[model samples]
Target: MTSTKTMLTLAVATAAIVAAAPAAAQVSGIATAAPDSAILSAKAFGAANTQIATTYKAQLDQATAKQTALTTQIRTILDTNKDGQISQEEYQASQVATNPLSGRVKAAETAGQPAIDQLRAPAVKAQAYAIEQVALKYDAALQAVVRAKNVNIVLSPNAIQYAPPTVDITKDVIAELDRQTPSVPIAAPANWQPSQDTVTLLQQYRQAVYMQEMRRAQGAQAGPAPAAGTTPPATAPRAPTGR
Candidate 1:
């Protein structure tokens, strides 16, 4: 999941709201402090998510192709009767018979998982680290801003009205992160099992594709059933009978 800026917590009710008066009025007493942290948070989270998204796309494509091929192979094996199809009963029975060796299939099912984790895990960890680094930078910058304004409490942008352009600190935080971190690859686990969710989803998808093919083959074999009540035409007579 993508990260988000921290939530705002401030009492805006007691704060003064400045309404525009005639140009002659002098503005005074209203105070505001911009949220540099929120800006930094947005930038850091956005960059991390973008990197993660690209990684996820590649992993998803690879997994999907592998799954499609395996489904076709499994379906061919299951429809063993070759009457062009298998009934649900036939399919279930075949699976049961073959189920004794399912450990092999499970191993295969688990094979692609490491690649997926290799793409996803590093992205997650990198984003987490980047978030921490950026937060620290934001706090340091914020303290300076606070000391300059002599404000003890600073609320996020959502809590205030009309912050000056100088108040946003996101760019600085992003700059620091960009300077310190580089994109890194996720390493595969030594013995990571396939995610159950991914396995289950692929299984269901393959089952649907298999069922469709079975139905199509059945349709082809079902052709014209002996033309209603008429008996099937007999084979031609043997030549010269028993000469």
Candidate 2:
């Protein structure tokens, strides 16, 4: 009787295994197709972005050149001796001198600022638009790649501590983006202005760059700071203390 019951249990187990085989195969196939923790980086896509950036930079370069010319002209007028350089004395004299040159320099700076601001406004808007367009294209391409590869998870390269090169899909995404969006329009529409958020961010970025440049220039002109623990020499030992 025991041998007959053991045979019955073996038959039931074999039937169960046969029934689960197809389901196990399906699960294995899905696992093979979908990968977890795939990484993508937007930094890999820059060809189209670089073109837009270059356009904006050209505008800034033109404005900078004009400003430099105006500054050079003012400096020439201050160098009354035709020495091609303005001494400290010359700089001080130019500030208080009765000559019309000082007045012209001051007027040029005051008038030029408005023109510079006008030029900068459109350039800033164009840059913001270009960045937005590029970002949209990148996101679309990233989504397409994710779908095509059946990726279960995505992570930015910056956020990952360690990832094998094989798991990075940045190049694949960039290729897809290049095919979808080969170029980005950098021109700003008439009277175009960035959104308040973008404007605030741009203003902050400009301020930071300005402050950094100012600090760099000041440091260059002022020499390095003294080392720590530095002290002035004693003055003849103070002639010794009184008894």
Q: TM per model?
A: 0.31, 0.41
List the candidate 1 regions with Cα displacement exceeding 4 Å.
Answer: 1-7, 11-118, 149-153, 164-243
Instruction: Assess each prediction's global lDDT (C-alpha) against the native.
Output: 0.40, 0.47
Clash list (residue pairs), candidate 1:
none
Candidate 2: where is the Cα deviation over 4 Å? Answer: 1-61, 67-115, 190-243
Question: Candidate 1, after superposition: displacement of residue 68 in Å?
Answer: 13
lDDT of 2 by residue, 1-243 (tens): 112123235535544444456744322212110111111123322443455446556656655665556556666666778876666766666566475756766776666545554445445565555544554455567667878877644544433334456667767766676678766676756655554433433344445445565476457755322211111111000011111
What local lDDT score does residue 138 receive in model 2, on the 0 to 100 scale?
Answer: 54
